[model samples]
Target: MTATTLDAVTPAGAAARRPVSGTVHSWDLSTGVDGPGSRFVTFLSGCPLQCLYCQNPDTLRMRNGRRVAADEIVAEAAKYRRFIRAAGGGATISGGEPLLQPVFAGELFHRFKHELGYHTALDTSGYLGARATDALLRDVDLVLLDIKSWDRDTYRKVTGRSLEPTLDFARRLADLGKEVWVRFVLVPGLTDDPANIERVAAFAASLGNVSRVDVLPFHKLGEAKWAALGMDFALRDTPSPTPREVAEAREIFASQGLTAV
Candidate 1:
């Protein structure tokens, strides 16, 4: 099991340490929070969407995480630069939704880029507004944007939000020449529909600067977290996506001239 720790400090101490202001719900200062390649990742607090498959349900509540300053986060991230450089990886600011805390993320990204010179990435669901998108994109080097589904109805059913904003955000990123890796969770009988996959592939092909497409096979890793939070697990009986299903989705994207990772 993956273990997590929480650190709480006084506002004054936090302020004196970092120039940026905001609350950090939780943070993982370890290597490989997302995958291989040693890197530091900060799990920012708060989110606007209620994705049914989200594993970090505790981060959904805005008030539940500890309050932390931006500089403090930067300071913590700086310590891992050597590891990040050696592994060809850097710091990634993830969330409940990083865009929800634009100011904090912006400040952190600016410091990492200009001050520390560490590569930066944003792992988001891409549901932020135009203004927020512009601010967050200024310093982000790589974007791991999640596109839940191409159909508005399916997106609404899965994430409890509209699909237009996310699509618009993706387009905006492409226009800015930002490197984006579009990700989709391949959920059986939900997002794995061949028709939907074709539509999504077509849409992604329309965007420029999308270097990669990732087809993530859905798993029930977060079900226990949901149960612990006393929240209903919608995909309780949903089996993990099969290898054949994943291969099919990959093939769909490959045929669209996009490299599927």
Candidate 2:
């Protein structure tokens, strides 16, 4: 988000000088939910933020991830290449902040694009977007960018990081005309605020590159995970968005002329 360093990386740079390894939490073969078509989604490991509502808190630490070479991951994904292609999906590299391991994630994405000849998508918070090399972004066909909140105070409280970085990255993507799908989680008493959503939608509209918006209703499904990790679940009493609430949120995005699903 700070000006990009992506241009500084070369395919034969450090990425190729050694075995670019990424810490992986898991991977899944899923329908077009993450991007277009059926995809081979790799959940890379490590993150800088400690979001209060993380569903996979287990993946928050670098030590918890299994180290792996980028090539090895591509080989594993290659097995399902045909299936993924036939289903119109390709590959998606998600995180625990995929940007945390920029070189590793970039290598995997680069290989998928050059060797596998498949579309690639990156799921990131953009908190570490400055870590991403331009080469990495070029390989990405789409981005599932999560802009958690628009209010500065609320944003800091929600993600424990500055909101400007995400906006900077979003602006950079818009400048590149990259296709984006924005995901917003609806926590009724929190992110579901009308003004907050309106501001988010307005900012997204200004971007002009966003094609889809997903209004995800928050749930307590991660309560058990929090307990297992011995972390207090502050939103335990917060309820999920009602149908009416979700509709209203979606309507806000739609007012911007963007498709809100």
Candidate 3:
């Protein structure tokens, strides 16, 4: 999508200011899942990985999204400020992989935090964490980092990407003292290996900055999306983790001294 320039006044005379724009799939309001309370969540389009259980296959490509400027998104968020504030909530910029358009993500967070005086969170996989500049991170109050797997081989199999980058990003965030909430999807037979779960738990606990760990049970909510997109639903037969299995996984993280939910 092409960038649009906005008119601005300079000390010398009228000037042009180009705000960062990005391909946004859509946005929504949600509570208890996205962040602290209620949140105006913007879902940007485009991603590098092809996970087997991706729920939003329709958001996998930039072409499927509408081009929107950071300002436009910020304006829309302002409309929800009152309600969100009343709920002790804020704003979140989620993806298909937000860091894929780091500049646009940064601009949105900067405005959400500074301009709107709201708490801001970035929902990302950390695969493109290197793209997130310190300036961009400065405005982010929280990061919801998805760590798919602790096993290198399993990670690549799940995301079609190496696990090293995510690990590196986690360490970087730790060093930066950034508050992070780790999200782990519990897929039976795939990610439920107790050993793998232990490794993840150990790593997250060591981070020191990890405030919460969300053990998300796997589901087929996206199977229909895959069918609609004409893509094979590889995990169609894979059942959701049983309640017992989910409890066991959460216990693993809790054993690590992390507040797992």
Candidate 4:
């Protein structure tokens, strides 16, 4: 992708423009889905995971997104800073996996906090390298971390990856005292097993920084996206998690003393 140019007058009043850097699939400066507060959401590009139920399948291809400067994103987010502040909310950087583009995510959050005074959150899969972790967490206020599954074999089958790194990332986040909300998609046959739910609850309970757990009921919302891209939908025959399933999963977490939202 071609680098996008971002023009900005320097604080010294000099005429200058710099190339803002980062791969961004798209950005919705304001979205209500991310957290308690209204948010200015930046959907970054690229992800390593290939979850069968991924809703944004198009985001999995790193090359498909546009390259934009971090400054450009900050500019757009700045426009809504007041609205974010008024609503007790802030900016949330989500992605194909925001951690995949550490430089951009870090710079965006840094600018948001230091430059614009907006609260910052990262919605991520936490599959980033150690260096990326250091960068991405620098100014982040909250994290919406997706814990794919508890059982290693089941995790591998669902995401084409192991669960160790994701768990390690969560532990590190907790060590840093970062506020996190652990999100799990309750896939009927995959994630709703009694044993798996209990395991997940135990894992989450061990994390001090995990403030909440969100049991997102799996749906066919992404089937069309998969069809549009001509990729076979892996969970096509699978039905959505029933209300009772969600409640059971919620109870599993609640048993561990963690609120499931």
Candidate 2 ranges beyond 4 A from true positions? 1-16
lDDT of candidate 4 at residue 121, scale 0 to 100:
88
Q: Write the per-residue lDDT of candidate 1 for residues 189-259, one digit (tens) a residue.
A: 78888999999999998997878898998999888889898899999989988798899899999999999
Query: By TM-score, how accurate is candidate 4?
Result: 0.90
TM-score of each: 0.89, 0.93, 0.94, 0.90
RMSD of each: 5.4, 3.7, 3.7, 4.2
lDDT of each: 0.79, 0.84, 0.88, 0.81
Better of 1 and 3 by lDDT: 3
Ranking by TM-score: 3, 2, 4, 1
3 against 4, candidate with superior TM-score: 3
Model 4 residue 9 CA deviation in Å = 20
For model 4, residues 28-122, the per-residue Cα lDDT tens digits are 85555687678888887778899999999988876779878777888888888778888998888887888666656777888888899988888
- The whole-model C-alpha lDDT of candidate 4 against the native structure comes to 0.81
Over the stretch 1-261, how does candidate 2's per-residue lDDT look in tens digits? 111332233443454575567678888888857899989999877788777778877777766678777778889999997888788889999978898878778888888888888899999988888877788899899999998889888888878899898999999999999999999888877788899999999999999999999888888888898899788888888888899999999999999898999
Q: Could you tell me how far off, in angstroms, the CA of residue 100 lies in candidate 1 after the best superposition? A: 0.8
RMSD of 3: 3.7
Please list the residue runs of candidate 4 whose C-alpha ends up more than 4 Å from where it truly belongs after superposition: 2-19, 29-32
Clashing pairs in 4: 20-69, 21-69, 29-40
- Residues 150-201 of candidate 3 have per-residue lDDT tens digits of 9888899899999888899999999999999999999998999999999999
